[model samples]
Every structure is written in C-alpha cells, then in structure tokens.
Target: MKFTRRASANWKGTGMEGTGTVSTQSTVLNQTQYSFKTRFADGVGTNPEELIGAAHAGCFTMQFSFLLNEAGFTADNIDTEAKVNFEDGSIVSINLDLTATIPNISDEQFQTIAAAAKEKCPISRLFKTEITLTAKLA
Candidate 1:
C-alpha cells in the first residue's frame, strides 16, 4: 500500500523579516504561521523542527502500541515526547522519551518492543542523524 501527504508553505518578504503560512492537506495545520523569529528566535508561531518532533512522537507511540498488542499485551496508556535538535542550520538529533502503562508485561519485553519501534518507525528511518529512545514502564 502507498499513501501520500502534502503540505504547502508560502513566504513573503526578506529572510530575516519574512513571514510564512504553512498548510497541510489534513487541515490540522491550516495557514499556520512560521517565520525566522519562530525558527531562530522566540516567537509566537510553530517551526519545522517542532512539527518533526510532533510527527516522530506520534509515530513512535503508535508503533509501540502495535508491537505491544502483537506481543499479547495491551497498552493502557502511552505517552511519548520527541525532542528534535536543529543546530548550525541543520537537524542534529532526535531524542524520544516514552512512558507506557501496560498490564502483564515484563520490563525486558517492554524494552525490546520499545527499541524495535524506535528503530523501525517510518519517521525514525527518515532521518540520518542519531535517534535515541528512553522508555519507561509506568
């Protein structure tokens, strides 16, 4: 199976002073504001790195849940945070912190599943930089 998602960004003005709006086909982000201030400085809009973090966090959590279920365990709750580092005008690394609550699952099994999910997630595979996962059972 194949699927495609699309997003568009429109920018105007100079780089330092320019402003842009990002729109996605899903409409979850419609005309979302982003600018140099948002990316390089503290501003009132979202940035590309933040978006990538969100995607990674969501993808990893979902993949972990699937793995848990396949291993005969059901996750009662799963929370993940992806911190993406963007430095020197390039993406450096992404660190994922995950906490999950599942019944009847050993710590070793959970760790194995979490590591597999982190390694095999589509979003994780997209980046060439280092990706780290810290998982804990809650």
Candidate 2:
C-alpha cells in the first residue's frame, strides 16, 4: 500500500477500571481518552465504534463524490452518517445514511451510484458484516 496511517493506544490498569488514550500519527486524536465507560457507557470520550463510524462515513462520502463525478454529475452537497452496530462483541451490521444534493440526476441513477459507493468504500469492504444504505437526493 502506498498510504500507511498509524495509531496507537496506551492503557493503565484493568479493562473495567483502566483508562487509555489513543494517538494518531497526524495528532488529530493526540492522546485522546477512551475507556470501558466510553466504549460501553456514557463516558466523556471517544469509542472504537464511534471511530469506525467516522471512518466509514468519511470514506463512503468521498467515494460517492468520485462516483458522481464519473457519472458526469457534481453534487452541491453530500452528507453521510455511518452507524456501526456492535452486538455480541462483534460488529453485526452498519447503516449508512446519506443525503445529497445533485443536479439533473434521476432517482434510479442516484440509487445505483449510492449502492456502488457503499460497496466500494474501503472501510465497508474491511468489515465482514451486513451494510445497509439509505440515500436521499435533494
């Protein structure tokens, strides 16, 4: 791979009571706090699922934009949200919600492009689980 992004985590103590901080090479999440509370409860920090959701959303949106460009369409706006559903200590599914504003595009075309983007996004491909998408054109 030509691109290599990196992140690291540090923890002190047991999983339940332990506190940890995650850092990325870009320092966007420099020593960001994460713990059991953050992952499974109402804690004031980031969680793994949340990060996964963000990555999926970012990747999917970019892929959608590129697909649109290839289809000879330019979107005025493209909004996407990814919800990673964690169950039984595994990621069972993911739901991608998208709203886009593009000119001169039919619903059939939009749906095809949306589905393509969802499937082609690297994060979506990385997960071995059901992925659903809801795309709205405006």
Candidate 3:
C-alpha cells in the first residue's frame, strides 16, 4: 500500500550558470539545471516537475482504461498530458488533458466513467492540489 523512490540532486554555481545532477538509486541524471532555459528536455537530466507530470498522466490514463473496461467499454487508445505549475515555492495547479478513443459508449457514459477514473486514480488521490481534467472521446 506504500511505495517510495529516492532521488538526489546536486547544483553548482548560481541559477543561470549552474547545473546539477539528479539521480535515483536506479536512475542517474546528470548535468541538469532548473535555471534559465533548462527544463525537462533542456539538459541531460530530468526535472522533478516533469517527472511528476509524466507520472500523473500515465497513471491517470491507465486507471481510466481499467475503469472503462469495468464499465463495459473499451478504449483503443488513451493519451493524457499533465501540466503542473509552481509558484511561491508551491504547486499552483495540476492540469490533465485526456484524449481517448473508446468504443461502445455514449458521451454521457464516457463522462461518467472518466469522472470516476479521475476520482479513483491513485495519482489523483496522492496530490492535494487543484487538479483539472479535460476528457475527450474520439
């Protein structure tokens, strides 16, 4: 019922000229900076926010797929994009955009299932921030 991951980071110089290494016991991320123009793809390492977004999106989509199946529907593909914004040393908002290609479902039913998935998803339960989800069925 509990899971955890350990990651480490090291920074040199100031925000602009500084670079850092972020590593986990399994993954080593080096030469990454959260300053200037450096970000998820800006360096050789990945940032925490980016990783969080990826985790949230991936988790939500998989949860949605399972929930839909339980609701007598199936998804051909479920893609989610998550955005997390930070401000004043806190996460401001978490936005999720989900596009699903589902079969044998009406819009109302899809919305119902998607709403249940959003509420029941493990990642959705983990964060205590404002989370917005836009679900599109195609």
Candidate 4:
C-alpha cells in the first residue's frame, strides 16, 4: 500500500533575508523563513522533516508496546525520543532512545522483544538512513 501527503512551499529573496509559504491549499499559504527553522523554537509549528521525526518516534513507541503485549508482557511506560541528524544538508541518521518500564519480564526476554520491535516497525523500514535504538528496561 502507498500513502502520500501534498505539501508546497514558496520562497522569496535570499535564504537569510527571504521568507516562504507552505501550503496544502492551492493559493493561500503559511509563512516561513530561516528563522522558522533555526532561530525559533518549533512549539509554534515546523516543517515536514521535523514533523516526520516526531511521527516516527511516537509511532515506533506505540508499535513496540503492541509487540510486547503480543508476547504476553505489558509495559507501564514507553518513552521514545528520536534525533534526526543533518550533515551537509542531508539526513544522516535517526537515533531512537526508548525507556520502558516492563514489570516481571526477564532481561533477555525484554531484549528480544525490543529488537523485534526495532526491526519490525514500519517507520524503520521506510527510512534509508541509519536507525539506532537504545532500549532501557526499568
């Protein structure tokens, strides 16, 4: 199956002095500039790349929880953080750190399930960059 999202951007002037528009609509748009990405904290909003990282992290954590449940284990908490590294304007890697509280599971079993989740998550398969996962069981 295939899925796609439509996005468009329009930039005016130079990279430092210019601003842009991002839209799903044909005409009306949202404004953006270099400050939108670098100088500003993204709590207001962000571009697709940042949004993708957020989606990947959250989706993977939820997927891991489901996998654990299928193995007869339940998790108290699963916190995942994903770091996206850009080198020379290219996406270099995505690092995922997952902290989970799983009651009554052996360390070995936890490792096995964690590995399964990392490899089996759909988002992991969608990316070409390196994906690193650190799973801590507490």
Give each model's clash number: 0, 0, 0, 0
Estimate the TM-score of every prediction.
0.97, 0.97, 0.78, 0.73
Off by over 4 Å in 2: none
Q: How far is candidate 3 from the true structure (C-alpha RMSD, Å)?
A: 3.1
Clashing pairs in 1: none
Q: Lowest-scoring 10 consecutive residues by lDDT in candidate 2?
A: 1-10
Summarize candidate 4's per-residue lDDT along 1-138 as a digit string, tens digits: 797757676777776655565665433334543334442334444555665687789888888998899999999888999888777767789898888899999988988888888788888889999999888888
lDDT of each: 0.94, 0.95, 0.80, 0.76
lDDT of 2 by residue, 1-138 (tens): 588899999999999999999999999999999999999999899999999999999999999999999999999999999999999999999999999999999999999999999889999999999999999998
RMSD of 1: 0.7
Q: What lDDT tens digits, residue by residue, belong to model 3 across residues 63-123? A: 9989888888778888899999888778888999988888778989988888888899998
Q: Whole-model lDDT, candidate 2?
A: 0.95
Clashes of 3: 0
Which stretches of candidate 4 lie above 4 Å from their native place? Answer: 1-14, 20-36, 39-44
Which lDDT value does model 4 have at 128?
91
Total residue pair clashes for candidate 2: 0
Model 3: residues >4 Å from true position, as ranges? 1-6, 12-17, 24-45
